[model samples]
Target: MSAPIQLRPDETFILNVGPQHPATHGVLRVKMQMDGEYIVKSETVLGYVHRMHEKMGENRTYAQFLPNLSRLDYLGALGYTHGHVLAIERAAGIEVPERAEYIRAITVELNRVASHLFWFGAFVMDLGGFSPLMYAIQDREHILDMLEAVTGARLTYCYYRFGGLYNDVDDNFIEAAKRFIPRMRKSLKKYDALVTGNIIFRKRLEGIAPVSAEMCRKYGATGPVARGSGINFDVRKNEPYSVYPEFDFDIPVYHECDSLARYRVRMDEMEQSLRIIEQGLEKLPDGPFMAEKKPKTIKLPVGDYYQAVETARGSFGIRIVSDGDKNAYRLKLRSPTYSNMHLFDEACEGMLIMDALAFMGSLDLVIPEIDR
Candidate 1:
């Protein structure tokens, strides 16, 4: 007979980090049980902003449902648009023009920069910094203006077509972007000095949410989350698509595996994206923007097609199943935030409630992307 097993008792408390909390960015609720200020367990509650977007895709025609793409991650409109368009084009066996492919790469890269800038500001703001948010927004507004001139929308742009872009970029747009890049480079320098080097900011982020490379892969995390953990897997580089293979850029990796590492990864990725954009501009080809044979009635073949693109948050995938009909039979979205959030329970354990929020911010979870 064995003696009764004794269990150690530890003081613990519960903390809720909000469905309406400022740091969440959208409707996300995290319930955490804590030992003093450190978390012992945590659960994330979602679906507050669910729109059943995949179901809508099954009912609506491919052309009619274009608007839904941007709504998933409104911050990276080009990234979302590229994923859907690539999926549909592959399903329909359409070829995008050379010029169109270059344009797609450029616009999507610009959108990635804008999205990262917004995240940089918001992440800092979560740690009680405000001025950097304002400066970051100022840089982001220039990107919005540049995108709006071509797409006619700032946030939720529905610009990409089935096989190519909706329209060609004019000389003025390219010139504006060329002018904007130099100014943006100078601004990024200031952002580094102001926020990245600040002692308080570094203190708040260091050693919070430390995840290993094994944990990142097990959780199916990508983008900065995986990169922060020393994984060199960028869809653009590992699985080259469109004009990405032709472009020269670096896949930034950080071994820190902490909140500051994730933050630095994104910042470094922004610099790399800027380089991609510049190279794309220099190599811009002259050709049609949209496929000349684009059909008004897209009757997709009976097959399933999967497409993946790297977004600001991470890799976004679209799975379209067509039944040789005008409308798709099934549409599935494999969003990055969903995969990234799965690691939260493991990362937040034994961390403080404040550190948990910082961890959440570091992952850069866009709730609508998860909920959709």
Candidate 2:
């Protein structure tokens, strides 16, 4: 063994911030090199929640692997699942019913809203405020209950299937959705009043951890992280798929490139999702929910295929390679958090520990998604 090297009393020491820390919100651990209350440098340590989701995909049939996507990002499960189904269906050239696309849009947007609500609460709580969590959960439960009424589960839902949805929505689901839009709008206005303008919240965020547009491109960060930095890109708009093209919504972008900017993106995104859900309901056509003559089993072309979707976090993409078989030869999941997290080590350098944590919360990381 080599001789132990000791540092002098004034040297920086390491602080392990998680793997159980509440501020992390998951099993993410930050190896932070600290000097007093400031971080000199940091390294994010992942894999605490790794499930090998890509390997899981390779081991199962396309249909069988569908549910696993949900486990990748628990808060934003539907978007991950949506990208999977879309990848498979697009490569196979399978057609979905018009009605199913509308319902999918409705449910997926609901999921997005639910994910953002939870993030809003958890993020504010990360900065030491707790009441937002209570209110946010209160609203999120309404979404979960509605999704569960049809999908049969709240969190990890496999309600969507290859080529279409497993079931058509009922009258109750539609009416509940109509009621939810206005209720959510009122709640959003309440949140703006309660949290957005608070001097403490603004002080905690405004100029901390500034990410440049060039920095976002360098790290391949997507979703609100890129938008917060004023890079105007969203897969739903930039690369339209499903019924996203039929609906009208704006991509919220802020050039401030700080925690507050990312916060505003998510808050504004909830409103846009509401606009999509409302438009989906208004233009919801009457037809079959699943494509007629679609095969019960899935088999893909010999070449590789890729699909991307704008998840609650950012872009979640799935790439599949096939050998004309029911199972994928290779499966690769491109998670936005994984790309977004790369910038943290460099970004947090010389930041006060509290501001670094707040900056991380602004990233909206889902640890399992990254580890996968």
Candidate 3:
């Protein structure tokens, strides 16, 4: 927690929630001005775990910075890696193989599912429902195992290469993924029963911290945060990348604009991610996973190039300025968590302290992503 701030002579005072508290969710510190149990205003203090990822991109070679992408959002690392690789490929005119596109899409979607599963567990745990955390983690373990079999890492995965994956997945990995879909569907049914339909859970979330469509726009929120407020903007649908256009999937949206709506959006998104994964597997083609003609030293023309990918959290983007060199001249990462977390100050105003915490949880923050 941060040191206490001085307050006026009135009963109103500042309360330091965390730089280390579990409720702040990942090295986040929130200074809340409170009147009794209600919050007057709140400010989020970041930079606790800043790694300067964009600076690393400038110093390292195009290929050397691949691992740094995973470190930003460890839960959905593949999506970050995808954005970085796609940016480099686009800038250098590297043509990725068709099979590699399918593999990238498949692995990224699986990572999305794992990320949402972990979020479901952690969010429920935040709300005082402990058992669902265990159930969610139990199901998430299967995805981790499946991804580990192919990527060789469970958590901070650096699986994708500039024009393909580090290696191609085998038949056994495909079989395991095929089995996982049906099992996960069954688990979702149980989750709906145990958490969604519960009266206590519904009461805690239903009308709390309502976010309007206008608020989302002003704050630059995306993913479930924007979707919950009835915005139909998904990076996958709006700007098609990889093999996502080849697959059919619905972008889940909820008009309620409350915490429940955000929760519902993520829950429904897991199903859509599963659909994409299944279609990618069914349409798997026979070809080399890596491009045969990639140069050893990647040098881009003197220009700016940008690539965007829809990660589990939201729109993740990489913008690179190249000077026809092996390394980037200027690199910037547009992380979704940073934009989403920007809404907290306005959103939490006049809310109960408990409700404010719940609202923060609904935003699905990963602080390192923000601090980066």
Number of backbone-clashing residue pairs for each candidate, in the order shown: 0, 1, 0
lDDT of 3: 0.91
* Candidate 1 per-residue lDDT over residues 1-372, each given as its tens digit: 999965346656678878899988998998888777778899988899999998999899988889998999988978988988888888787999999999999999999999999999999999999888899899999889989999989999988998788788999889988987888899889999899888988888887789999998888999999999999989998878889999889999999999999999999988888898899999999988889887778988888889998999888898988899999899899999999998999888877788888888999888899999
TM-score of 3: 0.97
Worst 10 residues of 3 by lDDT: 4-13
Where does model 2 exceed 4 Å of error? 1-10
Tell me which of candidates 2 and 3 scores higher on lDDT.
Answer: 2
| lDDT of model 3 at position 353 | 88
lDDT of 3 by residue, 1-372 (tens): 998876455678899999998887899999998998889888888899998988998999989998888988888899999999999888888899999999899999889999999999999899899999899899889989999998999988888887787899999999999999999999999999899998988888999999899988988899999999999989999999888889999999999999999999999999999999999999999899899999888899999999998999999989999998999999999999999999889888999988888888899988888888
Q: Tens-digit lDDT track for model 2 on 1-372?
A: 997887677899899999899888899999998998889889888899888888888899999998899999999898999999999889999998999889998999999999999999999999888999999999999999999998988999999988799999999999999999999999999999999999999999999899999999999999999999999999999999998989879999999999999999999999999999999989999989888878778889799899999999999888899999999999999999999999999999999999999999999988888998
The alpha-carbon deviation from the true structure for residue 128 of candidate 1, after best TM-score superposition, in angstroms, is 1.6
| Rank by lDDT (best first) | 2, 3, 1
Candidate 3 residues lying further than 4 Å off, grouped into runs, are 1-10
